[model samples]
Target: MDYPYPKTERQAELIALADALAGPIAARAATVDREGVFPYQNFRELHAAGYLGITIPRTLGGLGADVLEYALAHERIARACGSTALAANMHCSLIGRIDETGMWPAELLERVNRDIVANGALLNSANSEPDLGSPSREGLPSTTAERTPRGWLINGRKRWASLAPALTHMLVLATVVDGDSPPRRGNFLVPASSPGVRVEATWDNLGMRGTASDDVIFTGVEVPRDALVPIDGSATPGDGLGWSAFGGAAVFLGIGQAARDAAVHYALERKPNGMAGPIAELQTIQHRIAAIELDLLQARTLLYTTAEWWVARPAERGANMWRLAAAKYVVTNAVIRATDEALRVAGSAGLALTSPLQRYFRDARTAIGQPPLEDVALTTIGKAALGLSPGGNRDGAANHDAAVPVATVRSV
Candidate 1:
């Protein structure tokens, strides 16, 4: 695929930035994967190019690009390096969601914007827990926030917190403790350097090694009371959820595309000694390539189209969450299948640890376990079809769009 990018100047600029960064990011991908370390240099380059704040509105010291543009950028970067793109996705997703959410204090939000604009401070949500598993399926957080005269004292361990090694701020989900009423769930904005904030080196995995998604342990971490921001009405619900599901789909799709390209390139160059020349002359190889193309085309179309829809119809976001979740499942499942076919086409050559195809295969597998899981997505769609409405009033209210523009640095 070739996508006819939008006519907007902002989209063009973002595409250009992605094109420029692809080469260096691609060059370092293998090294980053092998070392299982954070892509510090890749991020430094992104900061220099002003992409760290790509989703922040221009008035708030960011480019003011929409969610569609953000998805486009992720697809481009992912084509080059899935690991780096995944890390950037976490940061970009957090920034975009936080900026949209009007819950944060004006002064604190402005401070965050300044850091991202000037120093490229990164952020990501630490929601997953070891015992409770994914928090998406209605589980109480192991993390606890206790009231203190100074502020709130937070304690807990968050597993698989992407970008943990470099995140400047962590949106920590915790059960608020205040004595009487049942503990309420809320998110606390904890600065990464706060005392007792420790990063455990536990990210060694099958793929996406560069994300450094280690376990982040918060012990007696304190933050101002003002930092507890409610997630509803503040964050753009559909867009925020879409960023994770849709953005993830883009990354895996890119990895699948890369795998297809590599397999095709290799098939054209390597010839067997049977009778003909390269395997490209064979019908079997041709059919496999065609299959990969078809899967990718379908996946990309759904991913981008839904992204555009999310931006254009903000009011119906609540209604469309089901479709978006389904889109993620459809696209990611296609990616896994496409990558497997590519590996089959390339045969032994694709299996080498040094081969990019191997990396794509492993990385593509990572998408299967992400939030809004396949079973849940299918269930949601099924429920919708049965006329049983899906749960979630997060985006149903009229006040969702009532947030003041962050460009003006409006206080809550």
Candidate 2:
């Protein structure tokens, strides 16, 4: 698929690299999805294409692509395979957020950037805990780290850690020991080969089966003090959530477009006994395809435009996280609708195990459940429209006490 928006010479070149990888990625997607296995080959290809460190600074030997470029990559990769794109999103979003936000030490950031650029190391932030639900919501990770003379010893469990099987580095969110004010929340970056780190394969889902969002167990995992990155507990403060939302929107947009393409292809080839020609020749089929095209156009426009806006104004995003959430909500919802419509147009044949449309439908549904979930997005929009203040940050442990048990929505 051609890129939906205009790009700079560099952006167009980078996007071409991503587009070139789509074939092999799509070829492996079905088997990976069927077996529920991690797409290591896909990651290797992305790494070889220099996508793993695309967001890292050029000074640090990375592509130094902007937010729009990143989103375009996500959208294009996802067009071929949703699972591969989804897993890549976890790695890209985490690193992009760290680079853009600059909360950690310069040396530490440089080390991470060098690792990605030089060695093709993959990283993802593990924050979701089974007990407290979504980290973006009223939950702090129950993972705890103790102060050691060398550094910190981390021992805790993280659920839905995307790209776990392939992670070269993990940013573990944990509660730290404080004198008396309160237990501080810090993110500790631990190497994947650490003696105590374990990846438990627990991701067996109806959609995005190849993402490998399994459980990551940290048992006495040790990291230096420099590994601990400070986190501000406000929703609007960090760039991580915003970037992740954009990535999610891009994934669904691709999935939806794929579904439309599949349906149209099937319609053009399949002929019925009573009909004079293929389904595509029918007026009804033409109208349904037109509707799907309209949805794709609207969703793609919002997805790219918002990303460009963020690239143009990074400072305002910290205060306008709601806009990011809204974009995710709009594009994801549109994709889900497009997939459903495509299924209707394709008839029962689309539900066959051999059909890609069925897989697209399942993948698109998962988009609605990704971070800054639909309910949370709606709440944020409502609060903004009502002129209410976004709430103050609650300490990590304090949040656990008041957090009610809400339905867990996993993002991979």
Candidate 3:
């Protein structure tokens, strides 16, 4: 009920900027999705408006607002454009993770922060491979990062490298192979223009088509020693992924709310012959709309509440992880259900490409399908609630994550 995030002047500026950034994108969301084209103009507006640096702290080039504010900003963008929102969510959130870690070279982090402020440079995980659906934590990667005299030589193909076209850098994750030490997997920060790096541009996606989530091939791509920056070298990996994951739900949930709003607008205006009133007067339509409204309220509150908790106490391991998993699981499904209901309320017209409802429905479906799949979350939660362990009661990683499937590509 009360304000959920910081009310600082910078936060207010970001809120105002986010509204401005969404305006033009809101006007073109449907067409961009239909044509599968990037919203460069919209991105420029956001870039110029400084929403791209919403997560960056003032000490850095960013406004440095709280996490909840970032999530709210994400919601604003997502309601206007799913692709842009998702891309910005990843970029704004990860910069702090790597920045705090003092992992990579200090010079590299400065360059990254500067690029994010000046050019809207984004960072995406080039971790997904053709063989592995979601890169396994414990799984051995086929793409090998071997240490060389010059630097790390990363060779592998990464699928679903979203935001490839607009990104200034790529965070490529590869397993290190060395005869000298025990196996350790490391994440590399490589510039988009490095040698032997190519985007296949095959972004034929079912949803969020404008994202430019193409397959990137890294053939002997060598990132200089400076590029293999690790946040862990500077900071622990604790709570980074969970905070980042739940942080984006507000955006997806807003999209569902947008779809619900659209359905309400149509219901209030459209009238059928002999029906004494607008579609809103009909009992069936009101019933369907009410269901969507409930989902929006429940999901949105959960998103912001959990976001606030993360901001207040990011390292509260048990509480943060459990609550975040619940929020991710709940809001994702809420969007799916809300979108489906919106389609039903809008009727056949909802299926038209010209209509925003159709785009909203499709994109919401894709958004919810993200990893830490709902089914897995339910299992993990159920296990956690009871005294039982997550997966392997013996080890925490096993309980939370399944054994990483070793991925090796065999020629088809």
Candidate 4:
């Protein structure tokens, strides 16, 4: 598919690269989903192609792609395999957050960036807990980080840790326990190979099964004091919702696009015994396809336009969080409907295990419950329109309690 939007030459090249990998990745997607296996080979190919460092700084040997570029590439990847794109989005969003926020110490940021550029290391935030649910809510993490003479000892279990099978580092959100002081939440950079860190194979899910989003148990895990990412109280805050919201919307949008294409192809070739021509001749099928195309176009337009607005007007992002939330909500729900329509178009054949439409259906539905969830997004938008305080830091207040992780919504 030709890129319809205007872009720089570098951006076009990067998008083309992503498109080139889509075919090979799609070839393995069915097998990966059928086996419920992590797409390690996909990540290897992505790393080799330097996509792992697409959002990192050029000074750090990365492609230094912006948010729009990231969205386009991610959408292309997701068009082939939702699982690979979703899991990889976690890593990319984390790195992009670090670059945008300067939330970590300079040394720590440099080290992590170098590792990603040189070794193809992957990182993801382990913020969701079984008990706490999503960290975006009011409660603090039950995961505790105790200060020790040597370093910090972490003890907690993180649920829905995407890319757990191959993570190089897990940025764990833990409540810091200090002597006689108020407990505070902090992010701990724990190496995947840490002595006490273990991955529990509990990621049996209905969709995006190749993500390996298992439970990561940190039992007496120890890391150096420097592992604690230094949160600067004075630095200008970056929009936590930008990359994840836009990138996630793109992923689901791609799934919808794939579903639409599959449906069109099926309609063109599926000829009934009594029919004069293919199902494509049916007005009902044509209507459904038209609806799918319309939804996809609207969703894509909103998503990309919001991303461009975000980059072009960084100063207004915090005040316009509702726009971001609306984009995500629209794209996610649009894809779900598109996939359903596509499945209807394919009839029983689409339900067969061999049909990719079923996978697309499942994957698209999975996005419904993701962060910036329907209720949350609607409430935020409603509040904003009412001239009320869009709570949860929608107005850009420094409320760490409502600080959402870069990868708040697990794709699985």
Candidate 3: which stretches are off by over 4 Å? 1-12, 100-102, 180-183, 231-237, 389-412
TM-score of each: 0.92, 0.90, 0.89, 0.93
lDDT against the true structure, per candidate, is 0.79, 0.78, 0.71, 0.83
What is residue 163's positional error in candidate 4, in angstroms? Answer: 0.5
Encode model 2's per-residue lDDT on 1-412: one tens digit a residue.
Answer: 3444546877788778888999899898889888999888888888888888877778888888777787777777998999999888878877877777677788888888898887889888788878957776645568998888988889999888888988898888788874464786677888999999999989999899999999999998888877787544333343545567676688889899889889899999999899888999988899988988888888888778878877787655554555666788888888888998899898999898789998999989887668777898787655544435232122311111121112122346
Q: Write the per-residue lDDT of candidate 1 for residues 88-185, one digit (tens) a residue.
A: 88777667776776566788888998899999998887887889665766568889999989889999998888888888888888889976868977
Clashing pairs in 1: 101-234, 101-235
Q: Which ten residues in a row have the lowest lDDT in candidate 2?
A: 396-405
**RMSD to truth, every model:** 5.1, 5.6, 4.7, 3.4
Q: Whose lDDT is greatest here?
A: 4
Write one digit per residue (lDDT tens) for candidate 3, span 259-366.
Answer: 988899989988889888898988999999989988878887887877766667644544325555678788888889999999999899888877788888888888
1 or 4: which has the higher lDDT? 4
- Candidates 1 and 3 compared by TM-score, better number: 1
Q: Give each model's clash number.
A: 2, 0, 4, 0
Misplaced by over 4 Å in model 1 are 234-239, 391-412
Error of 4 at 112 (Å): 0.8
Question: TM-score for model 2?
Answer: 0.90
Candidate achieving the largest TM-score: 4
The lDDT, on a scale of 0 to 1, for candidate 4 is 0.83
Error of 2 at 191 (Å): 1.0
